[model samples]
Structures are given as C-alpha cells and as structure tokens.
Target: MESKALLNENSDLVLISGMCVAEVLTMQGVFTFSSMLPFFFEEWALDSIEAGWISGIYYGAYMISVMILVSLTDWLDAKKIYLAGALVTLFSCLGFATLVDGFWSAIIFRTLGGIGLAGTYMPGLKALSDRLSGKVRARATSFYTSSFGIGSALSFLIGGLIREWLPWQSAFWISASCALVAFIIVWKLLGNYPNTTGLRSGLRSLDFRPVLKNPKAMGWIACYTTHNYELFAFRSWIVAFLAFALTGSLGNLEIQPSTIVFIGVLLGMPSSVIGNELAMRYGRKLVVVSIMVLSAGFSVAVGSSVGLAAPLIIGLVLAYGCFVTGDSAAITT
Candidate 1:
C-alpha cells in the first residue's frame, strides 16, 4: 500500500518536469535586454533615463498582465493561459530579433514579452498546484520554483555566449526557438485539470477584498512586493554595475560581467530549493526575515566594495544573489 501510494503520488512526474522545463524555456528571452544593454546604449544613443524605461517597462507590463491573467486562472484552465503565454513569448522573441531597431521598438517588444511571461509564470504554477497535493506537491513546487533561477542564469549566459560569435540579435532568435519548444512541450504534454473553485454566477473572479482583509495575507503580499523591488532592480543592473566597476580591469579577468551575473543567478537555484526546505523545517517567518536581513547586509557590503579587489567584490555579489533568492518559494507557498 505504501509503495502503491508513493507511485500514485509520483505519477505526475512528467507534468512536473515538463512544466519546469517549459518555465525555463519561456524565460530564455527575459534578460536579453539586460545582457545586451551596453550594446543598446551605444547603438540607440540612449540616455540613462531612456535606458531605464526600456528596462522598467517589461516589469510594468508584467505587473498588469499577471494581475489579470493569473486571476483569470481561478475561472479558466491554467493550461490554456500557459499556451497563450508561450505563443506570445515565441512571437515576442521573434519580433525583437528581427524588427527592433531603436529605443521605441525595443520597448514595445519587451512589453509584449513581459505579458507573455505573465501568462506562463503564475498560471503554469497554478496548473501544477491544481494537479498535486501533500509532500509530492511541496517537492514539485520547489523543483518548479528552482527552475526560475536556472532560466534566469541561462538568459544571461546564452545571450553572452551567442554574442561572442554572432550578432546580438542571434540571441533573441535562439530565445524564440526556446519559446517555440516550450510551447510545443506544454501543448503536447500538459493536460487540462478542472478548476476546483469554480466561479459563481455574478461574482467577480478577481475580487480581492477577502485577501486584502486578511492581515497575514496582506503581510506576505507586502513582503513579496519588497522582495520583487530589490530582486528586479538587482537583476536589471547587476551586469552594468559589474561592467562599470571592472573598467580598466577587464583585461585581467577570465569571465565577462554577464558570465558573473550568470554564475550569481545560478547560485540562486540551490539557495531557493534549500531555503524552502529550511523554511519547512524551521519557521517561515524566521527563515524569511533572516535571509532578507542577510541579503540586505550583502547589498550594502557590495555597494561599498567598489574600490575593493575584483574577486572579493564578485564573491560578495554571488553571496548576495543567493540570499536575494533564498526566500522566494517560501514566501509564495
């Protein structure tokens, strides 16, 4: 009975791995702009403020699209939203690869890409959650959550590696291919699960009054907001910060700033998975608060390390990156 029950719980392994891979693939183009920002700054003759908008608009679009589309998952099949988002991701990458020429065009496609991500990310998570329960569900969630870090690292590493031989646009083309593969995977492998909490007639799907009224939920929401602000800001600027800091010292380094960013983000995968385990064993509030405080201290130390040795600065950045991602799955769960 124990073995059979274990097998039953693990039967969704295909779905779990498929969704995780799809998530990773869908994220391929996310950091394309950030990884290639130096080239864009020169090619488009963009001022810092304009460049900031190009970076900022992606998240802005994501914020809006996720609120609506993820909310809709309560009523709609999450698989459908995931499919739509994957399609959008493919098109957005293709659009950016072939058509973007200047600042405005870049912004438009980045916004579209953001929307595509909004569709896949939470909706896909919802789909996965809807299909599983118990310890299997927790482990599956951690696996899925850890893929975001892998995807993020690949976003930087892939673009940087491609740009070594091919043009910058080639990275986007590859990213488009990844999205297409993700779309196909989900379309073929992910089956629709019934929404247990069916919406009642005349009631809104997105009504958040109850959520807002819950102080515990509200506290988590506030914490998540703060987490996102710092996380995104770090991702958006880490390469640039490294690039600027490494000026006159680039010749001495074996790795590029983008590679360092990749390594830093890659560290986040283990951090997230292990952090989730720790949160489960310890207390969530205790683990989260400790990680956040440690991350903030690292942030300060990194900022002050401008005149420090390159290796030391990079080490601090990697440590900071780990803590920055440590509490992610814990918070959401």
Candidate 2:
C-alpha cells in the first residue's frame, strides 16, 4: 500500500508537469501573435492602429475575465476551469487560423483567445498552489510563471521559422495544435482539486468587503498592477525597439526580430528561479522592491542612449528580464 501511494504521488507530480506545459503552450499562443503582427499587417493590409487594437482588445478582454473569473476560482474545480480555458484557447486558435481575414475578424478571435488566457493564467497558478506547500510551492510557482517566458520565446522562434518556410497561417495552425495538446494533457493528467480554503464561503456570502478592505492584499494588488503595466509595455514594444536599434546599427539587414527577442528571453530563463531563491533566503518584499527599482533605473538609461542603440537595447532587455521576472516569483507567494 505504501509503494502504491508513492507511485500515486509520482503520478501526481507528473500531472502537475503536464499542467505546467499546457499552460505555457496556451500562453505562447496568445503572446506569439504579437511577434507576427508586422508580417500579419502587411499581409492583411491592416493599419498600425488596427494592429494595435488587435493586441489591445485581447488584453482588455483578459482584464475583464480576470476581474470576473479570479473571484470564482475558489468556487470552481481548478482543473475543470483550466480545461475549459484550454478549450477556449483551442477554439480561438482555430478561428484565427481559419476565419481571420480582416481587422475585425482578427480582433474578435484575439479577444476570444484573451478570455481563454485570463482563465488559464491565474487559475492555473491557483491549481498549482493547491497541490504544493512551503518552499516547493514557491519553486513550482516560479517555474510556472517562467514557463510564460519560455512559451513566448518558443512562439517567436517557431513562428519566424514557419513564416520563412510556409505561410503565416501555418503559425496559427501550429498554435492550434499546441492548444489541442494542452487540452488533452490537462484532461488526462490533472485531477479535480477543490478549493477548501473558505474562499468559497466568503465568495458565496458576497463578503469581499473584508478582502477588499485588507491593506496587505490591496498592497500586493497594487504592486502586481504596476509590475504588469511595466512588463506588458516592455513586452509589446521590445521587438519594435530591437528592430529600430538594429536598423540604425546594422543597416536594415535581413536579421530576424524574433531571433533577437528569443536571445534575450533565453538569457532571462534563470531570473525567476534566482528571484525565488533570493526571496527564500532574504525576504520577498526586499527582493521585489529592489528589482523593481533596478528595472526602473535601467529603463531610464536605455531610453536615453541613442548612438549606442544596439547595446543599450540589449542592456534594456537584460535588465527587464532580470528585474521584472526576478520579482515575478514573489507575486504568487
């Protein structure tokens, strides 16, 4: 019986790993679309404003979903919620792959994808949190969030390669495949872990008055918002910055923008782990605040330099990766 119990425990860990991979793939599907926007706009004859809307609409949808779904996480089976989110992502990818022919079409599909993302990201975190404890929980959350970076990096690199060899639609098709795989894995591997943390009782009573009134929760929410704004702005603009900086320095060669972004992303992979370890050894507040301040300072320096544009841009990438992701590990804790 003990041996059987150990085997079950190992299987549970494997399931968690699958959940992590699926969540990452779905995230990659949403984020990689940004890297392909330049090519997409030209192919579909979309204006810059329209392209911006395509991306912005998704985020808007994501924001709304988070506001609604995060509150419901405690009431729902997290695995089921995750599975539903993955299915939505798969449907969104299918729409993007087949139905997107114009600006409005792209916007609609992307927004759908965003809704799926909203459920996947936070709920996935909650799911992992339920299954882990203490230092292990901290480490798992770090890995889970870092998977976002990994997924984004892979999306850019793989999308670029597909665009080189085939049509841009191939990228969407690949994303669809990933989403389907995620759905399958999540369905098979993840068991229903109900939230027993009194969140349900509180939510059912509609007594968020206490949670909202809590200063510590409010403070963390504030920090998360600020951090997200900075992180999103940098992510959305980094490829453009890299392109401009490279053009100025390298004279508009046929170098891939995605490749450059991938390089910076690769450099950032260790950041979350390092940050988590630091938080464990030192303190979460100290580590998080210090990294945020460092990121702000580096952003200023990078924005000021013109002649040394490429190096400055690279420095900014490294700083953003190090600081933004460094603090990210603490947010879940």
Q: By TM-score, how accurate is candidate 1?
A: 0.96
Stretches of candidate 1 exceeding 4 Å from the true structure: 199-203
CA-only RMSD, every prediction? 1.6, 2.7
- In model 2, which regions exceed 4 Å deviation? 1-12, 195-207, 251-254, 309-312
Clashing pairs in 2: none
Q: Please report the candidate that would top TM-score against the real structure.
A: 1
Predicted structure 1: clash tally:
0
Cα lDDT over the full model 1: 0.88
Per-residue lDDT tens digits for candidate 2, residues 1-333, read 999979866865775577679876887677666777667767888777887788788888988887667767777777777778888888898888888888889888999988998888888887777776766677778888887778777877877677778877778888888988887877776667755767657376344677689999899889888887777666665665666666757655566777777766666767877887888889889988888898898777766655675655666766666666667777766
**lDDT scores in order:** 0.88, 0.76
Pairs of residues clashing in candidate 1 = none
RMSD of 1: 1.6
